[model samples]
Structure formats: structure tokens, C-alpha cells
Target: MNQFDTSITFPNGVTLKNRLIMSPMTTLQSYYEGTVTQDEIDYYTRRVKGLGAIITGAANVEPLGKGWQGELSVAEDDKIAQLSKLAHSIQSQGSKAILQIFHAGRMTFPATLSGEQPVSASAVPAEHRDPNTHDAVPRSMTNAEVYATIDAFGDATRRAIQAGFDGVELHGANTYLLQQFFSPHSNRRTDEFGGSIDKRYTFIEKTLESVFAAVDHYADRPFIVGYRFSPEEFTNPGITFEDTGYLVDKLVQTKLDYLHVSLDNYKRVSIADNYKNQTILKYLHRMIDNKKPLIGVGGVRTREDVQNVLGSADLVAVGQQKLVDPDWPLKLANNADDAMINDEFKNAIEYTPLNAPLYDFLVERYGSIPNI
Candidate 1:
């Protein structure tokens, strides 16, 4: 417990109260135009009291990049005020808030953003059929368009700072825009932005550099910049753990704040189903040893499961479990013996609307929810 009580420090001298981080999990409850709503402010603030730092759900960088209905966006200036309110709410509760900036690429459907054609590294269509609705194949992005996309990330990062976030996290995992460029199966470009492994990473490298530069100039706060990257493409051949290691090694030299290591992109249904496998954490521990702060996330359900990887990783991230119990970090920190999943809370999450009422209700009642 002594080691666990030790303070956790991120790059740029940002220190957290503890090592329990609330991982970024998407909640599509924002205004259709992607503005932050009052419900969102309440939802995030509810969990801020007992956590180290909170990484927000995916915030689209551009309209065409949106992947879900009601998801928020940081692309526009008007949204900054709402985002600022959300950040202040979390900070008031004593938790640092990091906005997760993302572009969905081909995973976006036309229905989400006014029939706009989705863009990706290459023209390859996604293999999985849409759960919500059938959609058209996405078009491959041109070289110029790729560079423009990088610029969009920079713009979004600047906007996040304006909105009062403690930092910004580049969403590079789950076969999204950034991951699309990293996968050999997805990125078939022969240009400098693709081809060899080093070339394939050019877009992500450039995006990070550009965003860092923007944040450096516009914001005076000690901003932290980290990345969420997939270490492997489980369903795709030629994309193995070794290849991911090479990519991570390259990113380490970029002098970023943290590295969030995830195993498979969300497109892989089989791997997504078996997330509790301890082997994923073991592999991540072996791949990254640079002393940089690392956050490991998968299907972690119990407190012991989190403690098992405490020394091996800097932060233990829980998504589904947290949805079932927002007080999960508090329970684990205090070593409560009776912490268990509230089935009612789980059912509530399905209809929770991704806003404050649900979270506020949970905070008001900290016991297991009886079935309605």
C-alpha cells in the first residue's frame, strides 16, 4: 500500500493525488453540433472527487470526422465556452481534465454528420457492418488531405487549451484516423507518410509535433500532451506486437507526456470480447520500459486485478467497471471489502444519456442499486 500511496507524476511536472485515472470512454450525449451540454458537465464532475486525472471521451476535431450521434466536438470556437465550463467543474472537484481529441476517419457514417463522406489513410472500407445502420464505404484521403488533417488536430488542441483543459490527449487508438495510418493493412500509401514503418508513423509524429507547438505558443499553463495508441492490430496480419514496439520506441523519443498502451483496435470484435486477459498487460509491460508514465486499459473488473499491475504500470484505467460504479476508485483506494457491481447502475448506464443527472444520482446514492 505504501507504493500505491506514493504520488503519481506526469510529464511537465503535473502531479496527481493518486494513480487512479478515469479512462476516456465515449458518451454520445452532446448537442448534435457537438457542443458540450449541462448534462456533460455534471456527469464528469461527479467522478472528479475521487480520481487522479480524468481523460474525456472522444471529441471530434472536425465535422466530417464525427463517428457517433450526440458526441461532442472541440473543432469550433463556440464550443470552447461549454468545454471551459466542463473543465472548471472537474477542476473545482480537484481532478485534472484532459480532453481526448480524435478524428474517426472511415469509421464515421454519413448519418452522423450530414451525409459527409468519411476519410481514411487509404480507401479500404471497414469490415464490420454498422450496428446502428448500414453505411457506405469511406473514400481514401489524398496526401494533401492527410496534411490538412494534421493541421486540424493542431487547431483542436489549441481550442482545448482555450476551453481550460489541463492538457490534451491525441486519440490514436482503435483504428481511428491516427491508427489507420499506422496499420499496414489500412495504410497502403507509398509516399513519405506510408510504405516503411517509419514512414507510416509520419502523420502521428507530425500531428503531435504540430499540436505541441500550438500549445506551447498559445497557452501559459503547463499542458500535458499524451497519446492513446494500439500496440497491435489483432485481426490484421503483418501487424504484430513487434511492429507496435517499434512504433512506441519511435514515439518515446518525441518527448511527449505519457503513453497509453492499448492492445487491439476496436474493429476487432473477438479481441474486444476477451479484454480481461492478463497477457495484454504483460505484453505492454515488456514493450514499454522507458520510465515514462504509462496507462494500461482493458477489461479490468476487480480491485485485485488493478493492484496486480500497479507497479508494472503507472495508472490502471477502468471503463465498463467505472460505468457500473463511479466510486470504483474510492472503493479501491480505501480497500473496501464489499465493493460489487450494481446491476441497476449497469442498466442505468444504458439509458444514462451521457450527462449529469445519471452521475449526480449515483453520487447521491453510493450503494448498490436495486432492480427497478
Candidate 2:
């Protein structure tokens, strides 16, 4: 049997139809008010046919957590209708829909939150790699506000269940609020949510408690819950592979269905000085040791790449390739590689389902998303 066509079941008894998943990439196509636009639905509908599951781009759990313009939101109950449409669209093509939820924390801007300052574990400002961009120093989140944010994550999970999604992926990666609380660089608090690494992980622990409470109460059937995280950060005192090991150890003890490590390349080695020898995916695979399925992503554009990633990971997730060729898995299944888009395809927009906004975003930042 084709390995990619084999079904894999998670620890929670939720099984994926295949070993391929669509990485959650922001569309920049949602409405200004955070509602799901038809453009977003059409974009997902076009890409779901041959995947096991599709994770939607981060949806802010609260208004102040909005990361950028055109982001999706699960903050209010009214969004359920449109969100249901999105879930239905993906599942219509046989892919399980997973809602990726997050709070941007210090990664957001005041303008994006309508003049309100962003909040984080500490009043730390994010380091911007781009010289032209200036970031604001976020205000420290009050103890009460911190608890509220945790509750907000739970609320978002409940909304995902109401929206008919098959699962929810906590957007703990990407320097978002969850990562902010876990990173020593972003979390300098002397209180319960910071100080030691265990304290720094308190927010996530409590969050898992809250999220599972919702799952226990609301989910009528087996519903997958996954956590996505970066293995390390480039900043001094930022998250290290060691720190991620600790985090992963804690997460595996929870009811999480899987662990999704975010990376630019599936086989990229560790960036930390002492751990630079091993590929992050392989390192994680050894650490996880089949405790739960690990989803590895990055630069998977072809059948060989898919098989290579699946060698280390139980599932392979495609990011930019999905943008260039939404029907990649379908074509691969039919042995139609000759018809697939190549890196030289400059007019990909004319052939793919990329809406104007996402197409423009990819073109403007072509360096990051190869083969635009």
C-alpha cells in the first residue's frame, strides 16, 4: 500500500485518513472585522481534496490579540456561523478541519487592536528582524487579565466544537501569547507565570486544564487537540531546544492528540550551539518515541519530499507548495507529476486558487515563500 494513503490514528482514537496535512498559512483574505470571507472558504475548499486534515491560520481568541489585518477570529459567538461554513468547506472534500487558535500577544500592534496596547507576560518588545519595522513594547498582563486570557483560549476551543471542526490546534508556536508566556526573553515576570521554567509553563498548563474542561463538557465524540511550537528562538535567553524538550515532555502528558513542530525545513538541524548536530524533526521524533504522532512540516513540495518527511514524522504537512499547487496530493495520487507547478512558474496566480491578497503577499515576500 502507498504509505501516504495509510490511515493513522492518534492517541485519542481520532484517525486521519492519510498521512498528509495542509499547514496553516495565513490567507490575508478574511474580512476586516475577523469574519470568514467567502474568499477564505473558496481558498480552503480548493485545497482539501487529498489531505488528511487542514489546519486554518491562527484565529485570535480575543480582540486585543489580533495579529494583523484580515485575521480570523473565534472571539465572539456570532462568528460561529461563518466558521461553520469554513469547517464544512474543508470536510466537504474529505479533509478533517482543524481550527488553529491563538493570541498574538506582543507580536501585535496597537493599531491592529484599535489603539489599545498589546499585552504579554512582561512589558517586553519583540525584536524585529526587518530594519524598517518598529515594534511597540507591550504592557505586562495583570494577573486577572492573564487568567482571562487563559479562559479565552478555552472559549475559543468551545467555539471550535460549535463550528463543527474535527479538531483544534493551540497556536503555541510563532511567538504568540502562549509562547510569550513560555519564553524567558518575553516572560520576565517574577510572579507565578514566570521566574522558573516550570512557572513559565504555568500558563500553558492551566490553559490545557481549561481547554480539556471544555472538551470534556462539549465534545460529543473523539475530537483531536494538538499543540504547535517552535523548537528554538534566535534571541538571547529565548526558547532553546532544551526548553522545548521540557515543554514537549509536559505536553505529551496531556490529552493532546499530536505535536506539530514548526520549522522552515523538515530536516533542518538544531540552531542551538550544543545541539546543532541533529535535525530538529529527528531529534523530536526520538524524544517523542511514538508517545504521540508528530507532524513535521517545511519545504515538502513533491512525492519524494513527502516520503522523506514521513520517514521522521508520522504525518507530513505542506505549506508553500499548497499555495503553488493546491491539488498536489491529488496529482501525486494519480501519478500526474508532469502537470504539477514548478519553481519557474511565474504566473502561478493564474493557475492556482490564491486570491489576490494572498497572491500579492506571497509575491511581495517571495524570498520566504519560494516558487511564488
Over 1-372, each residue of candidate 1 has an lDDT whose tens digit, in order, gives: 214445777768888777777788766668889998887887787777677788998999988889887787998889999999999998896778899999999888777769777888877776665534446467788888888888889999899899889999899988898988888877888888889988988998899888988888888878889999876675564356677778778878786888887632212222443344546555566567745778776666576666765646777666666676677777766777376564555455655444464454444444553211
Write the residue-wise lDDT of candidate 2 on 1-372 in tens digits.
238889999887988899889998887888888999999998899889899999999999999899999999999999999999999999997889999999999998878988888899998888763424445788899999999989998999999999999999998998999999999999999989999999999999999898889999999988889999999999998999999999999998898999999988887898877777778998998889889889999888788888888888899999887887888999988999887777643466556657788877776766464532
Candidate 1's TM-score: 0.86
Model 1: C-alpha RMSD to truth? Answer: 5.5
Q: What residue runs in model 2 are displaced by over 4 Å at the alpha carbon?
A: 129-135, 344-347, 367-372
Candidate number with greatest TM-score: 2
**TM-score for each model:** 0.86, 0.95
lDDT of 2: 0.89
lDDT of each: 0.76, 0.89
Model 2's TM-score against the true structure: 0.95
- Which is the leading candidate under lDDT? 2
Question: How well does candidate 2 score on lDDT at residue 284?
Answer: 94
